[model samples]
Structure formats: C-alpha cells, structure tokens
Target: MLRLQSALGIFALLLLAFALAENRRAVSLRQAAIGLVATFATAILLMKVPVVARAFGAINDAVGAISAASRAGSSFVFGYVGGGALPFDLKVPGADFILAFQALPIVLVMSVLTTLLFYWRVLPPIVRGMAWLLERTLGVGGAVGLSTAANIFLGMVEAPLFVRPYLSQMSRSELFLVMTGGMAGIAGTVLVLYATLLAPLIPDAAAHFVIASVLGAPAAILVSLIMVPETSVRRTGGTLEDPEMEVASTMDAIVKGTGAGIELLINIVAMLLVLVALVYLVNAMLGLLPNVGGAAISLQRLLGLVMAPVCWLMGLPWDQAVTAGSLMGTKTVLNELIAYVDFSKLPADALDPRSRLIMLYAMCGFANFASLGIMIGGLGVMAPERREEINALGLKSIVSGTLTTCLMGAVVGVLS
Candidate 1:
C-alpha cells in the first residue's frame, strides 16, 4: 500500500508539472524518465545502501561534533542561557533558551567554519564534482549544474556568484532550474540548527537533512526541466570563470562569514517574530467565525483542509492527514523554520512514527512565498537584466520546488 501511494505521488507530481508546462509540446519524456530514475536511485543509495549509510553515519558524527563545539562556544559567551551549566546556581524553574541562544548560534559557527573551509579551497572541489556528476547524469548545462550543486551549501543569492558570468547567457529553463535548486535545498549553515531543533524527535536529524539536500538537487532540476524545457542550445559542462576571489586571510574569511551569519540570524529572528504574530492576528480574526463542532477554526484549520488531500496522496492515513497537512501548509505559506518549530511542538501522539517521518521530509524546503521575494531580490541584484524574468518565473519555481520536496518524501516513504 505504501509503495502504491509512492508511485501515485510520483505520477501525480509529474503529471501536474506537465499540465502546468509553459510549452507542453516541448516536454521530453526521455529526459523526465532519466531524471526520475536518477532521483530514485540517489535516494536508494543514500538511505538503503549499507555502505552509503555508513558514510552518512560518519558525516553525521562530524556534524554532531560541530554541534558540541558550537555549544561550547555558546556556553562560554552566553553562559547557562546557551544550554550550559549556570555559572552561579539558582533555582529558577524554566526551560533553557533553545532558539535564540542555542540552536541559532550554530548557524553563526557553521558560517565561519564553512567560510574558512571555502577559503582553503575545500568546498569548491565538492561542489564542482557534484555539478560535474549532474551534468553527465542529467544532461544539464554547466551553469545550472553548478548553481544547483552550490545551493546545497550556500544561499540562493550567494550560490549564483559561482556562475555569475553565465547567468545572463542561460536559457529560461536553466535560470528556472537554478531558482528551483535554491528553493528546494537548505543551506549547510542552517542544516545543523534545524537538526538541533528536530533532534529530539529524530535521533539522526542531521543525517536526514543532509540526505534531503543531496536528493533535492537533482529533483529540483528534473521538475524545472519538465516545467520549462530548454528550447535554445546552450553549452554543457564547461570551465567556470573564476570570479576575482578576495579574502586577505583565514581570519578575514572568518570575520566576513560571521558577519553574514549575523545578518541571517537577525533576518530569521525578525521574520519569525512578524510571521508568528501575523498568524496569531489572523487566528484571532478567524476566532469570530462560527465554530464547527463547537470549536474555533483558524488559519491552520483552513490550511489543513486544503492540504489534507496532498497528505493523503503521500500515504498519510486520514486520521493523521489533517495534522500533517497543516504542517505542509505552514511550510508553503510561511517558511520552513516556523513550520519546523510547530512540528517539534506537536504532541507525541498526534502522529505515528511513520507519518511523522514522512511529514519531516515533505516539509523540508525553502519553497515558501517569502523565499520568492528573497530570490528575486538576491538573484536580481546579480543580473538586473534578468530581474523581470526572475519575477515572472517565481511562482512556477515555487510550485516546482514544493513538488520536488514532497516527491522526495514519498520516495523515502516507499523505501522506509
């Protein structure tokens, strides 16, 4: 039954993309088949193969160590508020500061560490290798391949810097692929923070997130290709122009990375504050509406109603589908951060282990409405000539990205 649902989910996503294609006649079945099979095979290797699983295990241990190191720094600076022992003991019965001081600081530490590693020419090789593999396996242009691979570690705006020279020359389909890749994958800077938030529920949360980002890259390209097939000829797998790299030293890299991380931290905190308050305000307004079964219905309930069908198609039973659907809606409407916060707070009995796992993967992406604006602002600045095009394709890319993440969830469900 789970396998059947997974198959149906895949078919539904493919058909939906085809139905929404700007050039339906241009949609290539051969290309779609290759992409779908590649994505499925990648998922299997990451999740099912024992050798690959062990590799991921080793990587997870490293991430765990990073988390510990970040905590050590956080404890030193913020003291007990950062999940450490209180400097001076006092009986204050309250929860530790998890979000502001603990989980969020990991982003800052990772940003510095990642920047230092990039300065040492560590990440470029990995990004280029993945991009090269994608180019060979999926027959995509280098610009799209490189941007997609870089999105695994960097922000949507920052990743495009790797292929900035080619952005103006890319076809509509290639630009769309780039957009979808950024939307579909989470940055490494925040991966550990999310893992920290979700670790209680999912013991191997860092590994799960790593797998999602890896699987999402190819899936993003597949959906983009189907939605907007390239009509014009473009170069495939060529040398990337080295942007004038400038970092005075490792210290400079760390300083700049930490500054960038502070900006991200501020954005995250403010965004969540405004969004959460908006949700509250909307729910309060909704409270005045007539109740069903003598219970007040809010935005989440409405969103749940709309999204429940999608959850059902993804193999969630009806009894659990509504709650899972709410999380999906929250993810798409708000950002994944808020949705994850809500998910972690869900009662233990609200969802079974399988349903919870499926929803976790399904809701793991940056395909919300806010991200569309960010992409336009960030990517637009790089190539002002393409701003209009970016705006035009924003909605389509979001749809493609959302479908990609959910499809990933379905595939994992089948294998599980």
Candidate 2:
C-alpha cells in the first residue's frame, strides 16, 4: 500500500510538470516525457550513488567541524551557559545558544570554500554537466538550463551570474523558470549550517541535507517548467559563461571570499535575532486574545490549521501532522530558518523519526517573503527591462517552488 502511495505521489508530481509544459509550443508530449524520466533518474543518482553519498559525507564532516568551532567560541564568551565549560552544550536542557550564535560559522566557511572552488573552475563543470543533461532531456535553452543548475549550489542572485549576458534577452517563460529554481533550492553555504542545526535531533542529517539539495535541483526544474513553459523565441546553442571569482589572484580570491563570508555570517546572525524576536512579539500580541482550549490562537497555530492537510498528504503520522504542517506554513510564509528553529524547539517525542526526516527535506530551500525581495533586486538589476516581469513572477515562483519541495517530501516519505 505504501509503495502504491509513493508511486501515486511521483505520478502526480510528473503530471504537474507536464501541465506546466502544456502551454509551450516546443514542449511536445515526447519532450515532457523525456524530462520527467530524466528527473526521476537524477533523483535516483542523488539517493544511491556512492560518489554522491560520499560527497555529502564530506559536507557533513565540514558542518561538524564548524559546530565544534562555534561551541569553542561560545564557551569562551558564555562560560557554562549550558552548565559546562562549553559555550553551549547540546546535552544541557534549553541550550539554544549554540543554534543562535554558533551554527552560522559553518555557512561562513562553506561560502569561502565555494568561492574558492568556483575560482579554480571546479564547480562550473559540475553545474554545466547538470545543465547539459537538463537541456538535452528537457529541450530547454542553454541559459535557462545553466541558471537552474547553478541555483542548486548558489543563491538566486549568484546563479544568474552564470547566464548574465542573456538576462535582458531571456523570454518571460525563461525568466519564470529561473525565478522558480531560485525559490526551490538553497545555497550551499546555508546547507552546512542547517545540517549542524538539526544534527542533534535527526541522525544522518548531513546526508539528508545533501540529498535534499540534489533532489531539490530537479524538483525545481520540473516545477518551473510546469508553471511557465518555454513559449517565446528560443536562443540556440549558447554555452554557459563561467562564474566570476571576483579576485585578481589566488591569494586575493581567498581573502575576498573570506571577507564576503564574514559579511554573510553577520547578516545571518542578525536576521535570526530579529526574526526570532519578531515572532515572540507576534506571539505575545496573540496571547492577549482569548484562549481556545486553554491555548492562545497564535500565528503558528493558525498556520498549522491551514497546512495540516498538506502535511498529512506528505504521510506524517496523525499525532505529528499538525506540528509538521505548522513548520511548513512557517517556512512558506516566513522562512526556512525560522521553521527549523521551531522544529528544533519541539519537545522530545513530539515527532517520530520518520516525520522529522520528512520535514527536514521539505524545508531545505530559500522560498520565503525575503526571497521575493532578492529576486526583484537581483534579476531587476540584471535586466531593468524585465523588472515588471520579475515582480509579477515573484509570488508565483514562491508558490510553485514550495509546492515542488513538498512534492519531493511526499515522495521521500513514500520511499521511507
């Protein structure tokens, strides 16, 4: 029965992809069929390939190192905050300081490493290889294909750099595909941070984070192609331009990348501080309202009500469906970081292992209100003529992207 349910979920996802392509003149049934098969095949590679699995293990080790470093720094500042010499001990009850301050350093280091990899031309080949496959299988233009592939590792703004020259010339459907891809996957820097964040709760979280990244890649491609098929004049046979390393020499690259990573680290810490405080404020305000069933009707609760059905569809047990639903809603309406924070705060035994794993895969992306601003600013700056198009597609991209990740989560649940 579970296998049948899993098959049904995969079929529904493919049908959704096909529907998105239906509007395009170039997207024949044959093309859509090929694209769907390719996506499934890629999903299998991400899950089963030994090389890919080992790469994820490396990422996990990096995350663990960062976590250890952060803990060392935290110990220096707040001695015994977690009832030990460590800055924040995971074994200590109610010790969220590690998450609040320490986890971001991993993002910083990963960002610098990512820049260095790009400088050496190591990353582009992998991105271009994925783009080539997407292009050949889906019949997408090169620019769109590369941008979507690049998005798996880089942010929405950064991915566009791969196809910067063609931004102004890209058709509306292509632009939408780019936007949808951005919303679907997360930056590599943040992936490490999230791995550390959930390590305490979810076993093998590092591997899961890596799998989520790869799985989200094709999921983004399929969803974007579905929402807006390639219908306009297609540019043919253009190769992907290499990403800029933004440095003059190897030493320069290292220094500059490190500096940029510091800035990113600071921004992440500040954002978390502000967003967490804002949630508290909102909850306090809601607490003033009359209580229902001895609990105040807060935003999280409201979100849970709205998203519970979706969570159940993803195969969460009944006891945990609402909690998982609330997290999903928070991720969509607020941000993934906040949702993960909430997930971390849940009581032990609140969710079984399976549901927890499912939510981790589901929430690993950049789909949120902030990303709209990012899309508008990043794409708008690149192609001023398409500013309106960027704005119009922002909300839909978020919707489609969130739906795509959820679809993947449903599939993962069935597999499990």
Candidate 3:
C-alpha cells in the first residue's frame, strides 16, 4: 500500500512537470517513458541487486581509501589543524575544523586525479559509453547526449565544453537539457567530500552518491523534456568530437588541474562564509518574533514549513517530512555544502532510517542559487552569444534541476 502511494506521488510530480512544460503539445510520451523506465531500472540495480550491491560496497571501500589518502596530503601541508595526525592532544575531532582546509583539499586531490585519468585516456571511453547509452535510449543528438553523460563526471561549466561547438546550433529543448543536466548532478571533484560528510549519517554513503548521480542523469532528461519540450525543429544530430583544452603535457595537466581546483576551493569557502553569515543574521532577526511550539522561530523552522509539503509529496512519513524538507530548503536556498553540514548534525533519533535514506538522494546535486550564478557566468563566457538565453533559462533550469532530484528521491521512496 505504501509503495502504491509512493508510485502515485511520482506520477503526480511527472504530471506537474508536464503541466508546466513550455510546449505541452511537443512533449514526447515515448521519450518520457524510456527515460522513466531506464531511471527506475538503473536505481533499482544500483541500490538493490545483490551483485550490484556488492560492487557498490567495493566502491565505498575505495572511497574510504581515497579519503585517507587525501587526509595524508592535507596533514603533510596543514598539520593537525587539517585533520592530520599530530602528537599534540588537541582532542578535537577532525570534523570540527574549518571545512576549507579539512574538506576542500579533497576536492583538489580528486581534481588532480581526475585530470590524470583523462590525460591517460582512461575516462573518455567510459564517458562515451555512457553518452551512447543516453543517446540510444532517448534518441537525442550526440552533442546533447555527450554533455549530459560528461556531467556525471565533470562540473557544470566543464561538462558543456565537450559539446561547445554544438551549443549555438542546439534547439531550445537541447539547450534546456544541457543546462538541466549540469545542475542535476555534482562534479567528481567534491563527490568524495560529500560522501565523507554523509558517511556517519548514512551507510554506503559513497555508493549512494554514485547511484544518485547516475540515476539523476536520466531523471534530468525526463524532467527537462517535460518541463521544456522540444518544439524547435532544428536538430544538430552530429556525433561528439573530443574537445581539447590546452594542456602541454602530463605535468601541465597536473598543474592546470590543481590551479582549477584552487579556484573552486576558494569559491566554495567564500560562498559558504557569506551565505552562512546571512543565514545567521536572518535567524537572529527571526528570533525576535514570537516563539513557536515553545521555541523561538528559526530559519530552519521556516524552511521546514516551506519544504515540508514537498517532502510529504516525495513520500516521506509526515513525522520526518519537516526535517527532511528543511534540509532540501537549505540545499536550494543556501547550497548543498551547508545543507550537508547541517544534515550531519541531525540527531540520530530525529529521523527514521527510511526518511534519512530519501534525503540522501534528494540532496545530491548542484542545484541552488549560487550554482545558477556560476553557471551563467561560466557558460556565459564560454559562449557570449548565448548569454541572454542562459540568463533567461537560469531560473527554469533550477526548477527542472530541483525536480530531477526530487524525482530520484521519489523513485527511491517507492522502491524502498
């Protein structure tokens, strides 16, 4: 009975997308069916099948090893202050320190490793295979397909570069998909860091993150197609050409990758500082208001009020819905970083196991206000002519991206 209710909820969300579609008449039922089935099958396989579960367990073990390696580098450079082993008795847990030093360094290391893998031609075949899968399943042009697949591994800005040449020629729907795909999944650089933050709160954290990204790819397609159906007839059905960014050699790739990682690291730290401070200020003001339920009203409470309905729709039990909703609200308004930070602090008894798992899939994405700005700026500079279009679609992309994550959460809710 619960599964049936969850399935109905998922259908309603899809219908909501259809109602908001730019060209309702252009919505392709065939494409939508394919995407939905593929997404469902992939999620079930990754999260449930015994053989696949074992593989994900191995992946989780690998992520643990990588986290340790990243900490080794962080310790060597920043000492005990950055989660490194030290002889002194600070007696503080590693999670207590500034995230920039302790967590963001993982991003840098992952970036370098990702670059090396690409330089050695290790990632291209896999990327192409995934792209091929999406293309064959959705009947999308190669360029759109490739960019969507690349988003699973690359950041929003970097993923579109693979299909840069096709951007100008892409139809409105294709462009929408490109942007939607970028926002729907996170970059590889920070996947491990997120997995680590979530490790204590959820089991198989690394595997869940991986599954969310993979499953979210198809969900994004389905959501994008429904919300912004392909009405334009122009199709750039060309095959993907390997995009070459200038890296003189292996050493150069490492240097460039590190530099890029530093830029991302600084950006994350700055955004978190400002956004967190803003949230504090707002909460302080809100504290002046009358208490609710014998406790002073807070930003968290307000967000919970706003998102609780959506969470309930996603099939969360009413008791856990508000807490999970607050997390989703935080992710949308502030960013997933602070959202994850807050989620890690939730008391074990505050939520049941099922709701906790649902939130895991929900919060895994780059869809937030800050990301919208970054996408506009990054993709704007890449293709100056499309800047207006990028700006125009920015808000809609956020909606589609948020819906994609919720859609994934809904699927998990049904299956669980």
Candidate 4:
C-alpha cells in the first residue's frame, strides 16, 4: 500500500514538472523513463546489493573517521565547545553539540581534503566517469553533464565552474539542467556536517545522505528536461576544467582549500543565524493571530497544512504527514540546515522508520528561497549574456529541484 502511494508520488511530481514545462510537446518521454529507472536502480544497488551495500556502509565508516579528524582540529582550537569533554552533564537529548564549533568545522577538513584529492588527480576521473554515464543515460551533452554530475560532490555554486567556459554556449535547457542539478544536490563539504548532526538520530546517516545526492542527480536531470525541454541542437564541448591544477604545492592546496572552506563556513553560520532568527520573527508575527483548531497559526503549521498532502503522497502515513510536511516546509523556507536542526530535535517516535527515511531524502536539497537568489546571482555572474534567461528559469529550477528530491524520497519509499 505504501509502495502504491510512492509510485503515484513519482508520477504526480513528474506531472507537476510537465504542467510547468516551457514546451510540453518537446518533453522527452524516453529520457524521463530512463531517469526514473536510473533513480530506482541507483537506490537498489547502493542499499540492496550486498557488495555495493557494503561499499556504502564503508562510506558510513569513512564519514565517521573523517568527522573525528575534523573534531581533532576543531577541538584543539575551540576546546570543549567543539566536542571535547563537557563540564556539566546533560539531561536532555542533543544539548551538548554546537553547530558552529563542531559540525561546521567539518567543511574546513573536507575542503582541504577535497583540494588535495583533486590536486592528486583523484576526483576528476570519478566526475568525468559519472558525467559519461549521465550523458549516455540522461541524454545530456558532456559539458552540461559534467557540471551536473559534479554537483553530487560540489556545491551548486561551485559545480557550474566545472564547465565555466561553456556556460554561455550551453542551450537554455542545458543551463536549466545545470541549475536544477545544483539545487537538487548538496555538497560533499557539508555532507559530513549533516551526517554528524544526524548521526545519533539515524543509523548510517552518512551513507543515506550520500545516496540521496547520488539518486538526486538523475531526478534533477529528469525534471529539468521535463520543465525546459532541450529545443536547441547546439554542440557542447567535452573538456572539463578545474582550478585545482593551478595549485602550486601541497601547502598551496591547504591554504586555498582552507580559505574556501572558511568562506563556506562563514556563509553557512551567517545564514543559520539570520534565517533561524527570521523564522522566529515570522512566527512571532504570526503569534498575534487568533488560534485555529486550538493551535496558533505559526509558520510551521501553515506550511504543514499546505505540504501535508505532498508528504503523504510520498508514503508518509496521514497521521504523521503534518509533522513531516512541517519539516519539509522548514526546509523549503528556512534552508535545509535549519530544517535538519529542527528534524534532529524531534522526538524519536514522532516519525516511524519509513517516514524518517523518506523525509531525509525529501529535505536533501538547496531548494529554499535563499538558493533561488544564489543561483540567479551566481549564474548571472558566470554568464552575463544569459542573465535574463537565467532569471526566467530560477523559479522553475527551484520547483524542479524540489520535485526532484521528493521524487527520490518516493523511490526510496517504494524500494523500502
């Protein structure tokens, strides 16, 4: 019965994309079919096949080791606040951890490691290989495919830089795909941070987040194509470029990586501080309103009211749909970090196992209002010539990206 709902959720999401398609007649059913199949296949392979499942499980271990290493650096600098022994005993759950000191620092470690890996020629081949698969399966050109594939590991803003030279040359559909992929996926630099925050709550949280991004790729591409079908026949070049090669030495990599990580960390901290407060402010404003159904009309409740059906279609039971939708709403309006923090604070029994897993995947994206602006500004800078066109597609990309991740959650529900 849950599987049936999951199946319907997938079609409903695709139908939403079709309804918003710039050229509905140009939508490629063959491409969409392949994407749907790829999303499910990727999930099954990563979670079901013994050998591959073990690999993802190893990823869980790897993330733990890496998180400890990050704590080493952070703990040295920040002392107890960064994850060292606490002076006071905690009675409540999740009170000891500090987001700024502990989890956000993981970005610095990841950035440095990522730079060294890229410098050592590790990530390029993997990205190229993935892009190759995307090109073959998703029917996107190499440059666009490479950029979209890179979003699995890189942030939305950073992924387009992989195909920086080709931005202006890419067709509108291809550009939309690039943006949609960025919105649909999260960065590896922050993946550990999220996993660390979620570790105590979800088993193999790291592995699940990794799979979320992996599965999200095809879903993003599928929805992108559906929303903005490729109407042009422009040829896209295959060359992939990276600033990593420009690094002078190991020290250079560390310095540059640390600098990049610091910027990301600062940005994340700032956004969290401001956005969480803004949500509070908004709820405060809403507090003046009269109660409805014995509950105040807070932002979460209102959002939950609107999103409950959507979450229900993704296989969360109706009884739990409001709770799940509230989280999804928090993710959409406040950003996934805040949503995750809120999710982590929920009582364990608030959501059943299936609902918890489904919500995790569904909320895994940069589909908030903030990201929409970021996408517009970032792409506008990269390809000034296409700024107007990009502006036109920004809202569509968010919708597409949101649907993409929800579709992935639906797939997870069906398979589970």
RMSD of each: 4.7, 5.8, 4.4, 4.5
**For residues 340-408, could you state the per-residue lDDT of candidate 1 as single tens digits?**
888889999888877777777888788876676667755675567998998899988878888888888
For candidate 3, give the lDDT of residue 233. 63
lDDT of 2 at 402: 78
For each candidate, what is the lDDT? 0.76, 0.68, 0.76, 0.79
* Model 4 error, position 215 (Å): 2.4
Model 4 whole-model lDDT (C-alpha atoms) = 0.79
Task: Output the worst ten-in-a-row residue range by lDDT, candidate 4.
Answer: 235-244
Q: After superposition, how far is residue 404 of candidate 2 from its true place, in Å?
A: 1.7
Error of 1 at 240 (Å): 6.6
Candidate 3 regions exceeding 4 Å error are 53-133, 234-236, 239-300
Pairwise lDDT winner, candidates 1 and 2: 1
Instruction: Give the residue spans of candidate 1 off by over 4 A.
Output: 50-132, 235-300
* Pairwise TM-score winner, candidates 1 and 4: 4
Q: Model 2: per-residue lDDT, tens digit, 301-392?
A: 78778777666667776678888888887887677877887888899888888778878877888877656655665566557798898888
Off by over 4 Å in 4: 22-26, 63-65, 114-123, 141-213, 228-237, 241-246, 316-320, 335-357, 364-366, 369-398
lDDT of 3 by residue, 85-202 (tens): 6566667444445556765577576667767766776655654565566566786766677778767756676677555545777888888899999889986657777888889888
Work out the TM-score per prediction: 0.75, 0.71, 0.76, 0.76
Superior by lDDT: candidate 2 or candidate 4:
4
lDDT of model 2 at position 394 = 78
Better of 2 and 4 by TM-score: 4
- Evaluated against the true structure, the overall lDDT of model 1 is 0.76
